[model samples]
Structures are given as structure tokens and as C-alpha cells.
Target: MTTRAGDRSDGTTVWATPAWRERATAWADDELAAQGVRRTGAVEQPHLRPWSTVLRLPTSAGSVWLKAPGPGLASEVGLYPVLARWAPEHVLVPYAVDAERRWLLLPDGGEVLGRRLTPEAADRWHLALAGYARLQQRVSRAADLLVAAGAPDHRPQRLTALLEEVADDAAAVTVTDEEREVVARARRERGRVEELAGVLADDGTPPTVQHDDLHRDNVFAHGPRVFDWGDAVVAHPYASLLVALRDTAAPYGVGLEDPRVLAARDAYLAPYGGPTAATLRVVEAARTVGILSRTASWLRALAPLPPHEAADVREAPYRWLAMLADGESL
Candidate 1:
């Protein structure tokens, strides 16, 4: 059975029910016990974007975050180990796994940095991003070995697929002629991104794993542990950077024009770097397409929304669309 948080009608989140949680908890206990730890209690923390449930379990040794993918759990199992092996220098170590329970036990890192997303936080984020860039360089090489060994391609195809699906529904969501025009423009831009993907796929190089969703909540400060590798994929080098740029820009109110966004992007691509401008453009286009598509999908799924909620939903995509339309970098 599905255990839901928030409004079920909205389809934002739902997870395994009491029995499922109990089974998962029992499995977690076993996993932790193997690691010389014991679970004392658990607290729930809800994440909004790509909604999921995080359980904070106190252990005899310390606390660890038990992230159970509401619906995306299997994806986590597939990607986390690969990331653990490839980007060891950049991400948090995954300590234990309960494959049947669809849960991952990560040492509870400290609070997330940039709670407020200020310029100072941006700089620190930039430094952290540089570390990710270095990690990506190593992972890119590792991806080749995995591919030769016959592993699946880990590109951001989900984003690509999501965009195409959303673009088709744009007309229903677009209430005005002007809005329709904007939707048309977005569709055209997405086409460019698709073309770029085809070009990349045709090239001889292997795809690198990317954290398709790289928002602040996924990253931890003090500990510098990047968690939630469920969205990892083997894609073009710039795919991860693009997601990071959009994530960092949104929190800080930094537009695409913000030098820090570009600087961070540059820093990320500096090592084992490919075509900076070209790759960024493709990723940027992809990001826009992804946002547009997701927004459209959410709007469609929750249609005839309550007036207040509908207004909020309607304004969400346009806000980002306006930012992009203004030719801002983010």
C-alpha cells in the first residue's frame, strides 16, 4: 500500500505504508548491525523536488540518514554503488544498502550549506563544484571501462524523454496567445537540445555518469557529502554541470548573467574539459526543456487546481521561462 504525505490528489508524494516502513526499518537494523550500529529511533524529513521521504535514524554510534525512494528507489540502488566507485573524491560514501527494502544508509552529515543562498554561499558552492568537476574527470574514464564491460549507458535520457512528453502538453496549459508563443519557442529550443544529444551519441566517446538532480538539498556542507545519486546517468560531460548551474542560480536569485554561474561552470569544466560553450549551450537548452516539461506535466496532472494553488503553479514555469527568455545565463 502507498503511504502518502501532502495532498494525494496532487501526486507529489507517496511511499510504502506502515508495514512497508516496518519491514524497511527491520532491514535497516540488520544492515546497521552488520556495520556495528543499532537504530534507536527515526524522524521524517520531506523533500519537495522529485519528491521522496528521508528518515533520520539515530544509531548507537551516531545518526545516519535513511533515504527511501518513494517510487524511485530502484534507480538509487542501480546508481549509488557506481558513484561510490567512480567519484569517491567528490561524493559521500554509501555505507550500507538494503536492496529488498529499497533503502540506502548514509552517515548523517551536518546541515546543508547555503540555507539562504547568499553570494558567500555561492563561492563555497563553487569550490565544491570544482571538486565535482575533478571527480567527473575521473568518472569519465571509469565509464569507458564500465561500458567496455557492457554496462548500460548512463546519460540524462530521462530528462530528454521528460521534456518531449511535457512539450506536447504545453498547449493545454498555455491560456493566452503570448503564453502559447512562449511554449512554441521552448519547443524549438528543446529541438536544438535533442539534436545536440544525437550528435553526442554519434561521437565515439563513452558517456559519463551525472547527477541529473543536483539541487542544494542533495548536497551537504561541513561534511561535503553529496547524497542522492539515484538520478545518476552516463551522459555528456556538461549534463551534470547544467543541472548544478540551474540549481545554484535559482536559490541565490542569480541570473544566468551572474559571473559566479559562469565561473562555477568554468571551474567544473576546467579539468578533462570538453567544449565549454557548446556543451553548456546544449545543457542549458536541456535544462530549460526539462523545467518546462516538468512544470507542464505537474500542471496537467493537477489541473483544475484550487485558485491559489493554480496561480502558483501557473506562475512557476513562466518565472523560469522569463529568466531564460531574458537571455539570462541560468
Candidate 2:
């Protein structure tokens, strides 16, 4: 039998191994029986990547998903109970979590939002953004709990040091001379990150769970449930918009400044202050410095990836950090 841990000498992830699958299958069977849900068909391994793996189990009730993250991303398993407690309406409470193994068994979260760009899609974006904003507001009070449960804390006050750390790390900034220059500029202007942090703090919106990635596919169509917390961080809530607006608008051939995008932005901002000039300023600042949080998330996930596989993906952290040099491009 294959070993239960460690990648293959050839650099394959362990989750693809029969030994790991056997352990996961046994655990899943026990969990399902406890819930009185019997398996009705063969289990399917639908997603397996360097950072995580997802197994789809057919059962009496319906299909349930089992996700196991690589060690670097294990915190995602511990986060669901906290999210369920704080924003039950917006995210699912996992059926069970194996804290030791970092695995989560979750109910089917319904259809993902459509990828097509349409007026209807914009409406869905508006609701998803607004609903996610509410989730952030609700989850704000659980910051300490979330941190204890392993969510990375990228709170506003910590931005300056985090900025310096990422900008100075050679491993994170190994790309281009232009990116090098951007990193240098970012280091010199580290004070600006501190200033932005102060502005956001004064705005009275407490730092909450920032889904470092919030796009159409991450949210659901049948309801407001948002999944994929592996990249989540506890930071200035508005920081989430950097990814939300950019990714959602890209497929539609629109930018963040588009009318549809602005409406969606306002929808998200409604919970905070509804796009007032001051709020917009705060948001722009958050989205700018939030780039570091994005870089940090990528670095965390990329840490354990095989060097050969991560050569291209490794450029992401530096690329995002370079955005700090470009002012308010969000």
C-alpha cells in the first residue's frame, strides 16, 4: 500500500494515492453512517490539485463533498464551524470536520453562479455581493475565534509589516526587474499602508473574514452560500472587492469602472455606507493595500507545491505585490 503522507518521488500529491483514499473512504463511511446516510453508489474523486482534493460521495440524501487541503491550507477545515455559527444563512455548516487530517464533509451547496455576462448576471452579482457584505458584517464579531481556528490575520493594523515582509522576501519577489523596482517602491512607501490601515480603522467597519477570492463561481445561484474558504483571511472586509470586482467583470469585457460593476460595488458597500465619497476613498485604499493580502494568500498555497509545477504559479505573489505600485487601479 502507498504511504499515507508525503508526495511521491515524482512529485505527485498524496491525496491521489490509494492509501490516502482508503483512509478517507473509511472516515467518510463512518461519518455517513453516523448521520444515517448510506452510500448508494461508487465514490468519485472529481478534483485533485496540489493544494487540495475533493471527493464526491453518492448517498441516500444526495451528493456530499469531501475536501482535504494540503497542510498549508488546513485551516480551511477549522473555519467552517465558525462561519456556520456566525453566518449560517450565507455558508454551510459542514457535516463533520477531521481536525487532525484537515478534511471536511459538506452538503451540496447548490448551483454556482453562471459565468455568462448578462443583465441577469449583474442582478445575481448584486445580490451575491450584498449578501456577502452582510456575511462579513455578521462574521466580524468572530475575528478572534476565526484567528484561533487558524484563519490568517491580515487585519488593517498589521498591513505595514506584512507589506514589508512580502516586498522584502526574495522568494516572493523573484520575477522581473520591473517587479523588483515596484517592490523597492513599495518598501519605501510602507508608511502609506499604515495610513490606509488607519483610515479603514477609523471608518468603524471592523476587520472581518475577507474571502481573498470572491467571484461568480465561488458563490451559489440557488442561495447566498459562499464556499472555498481555503484562501480566506481576517482583514479589512472591503479588501474582498479587489478580487470580486476584477474577476467578475473580466469575462463580461468590463472593468471595475463599468456601470454594472459600480452597481455591484454599491450593493456590497450598502452594508458599510453605500458608496459615499469617504467610503469610496476607504474602499479604494483597502483594495490597494489588500493586494498584499492577496499575495500572502497565494504564497501560503504555493508554499508546498512542487517546484517544477509552481514555476509559473510562483509569479502570482510578485505580480500582485507589484500592483501596490500602481495607484488605485482597482
Q: Over the stretch 14-54, how does candidate 2's per-residue lDDT look in tens digits?
A: 67788777888889989999989888888889988777889
Which model scores highest in lDDT? 2
Task: Please list the residue runs of candidate 1 whose C-alpha ends up more than 4 Å from where it truly belongs after superposition.
Answer: 1-17, 41-50, 115-120, 141-191, 198-206, 273-330
lDDT of the candidates, in the order given: 0.57, 0.82
Looking at candidate 2, the ten consecutive residues that score lowest on lDDT are: 1-10
Q: Supply the global lDDT for candidate 1.
A: 0.57
What TM-score goes with each of the models? 0.67, 0.93
Runs in model 2 deviating more than 4 A are 1-12, 170-179
Which candidate has the top score in TM-score? 2
Give lDDT: candidate 2, residue 22: 80
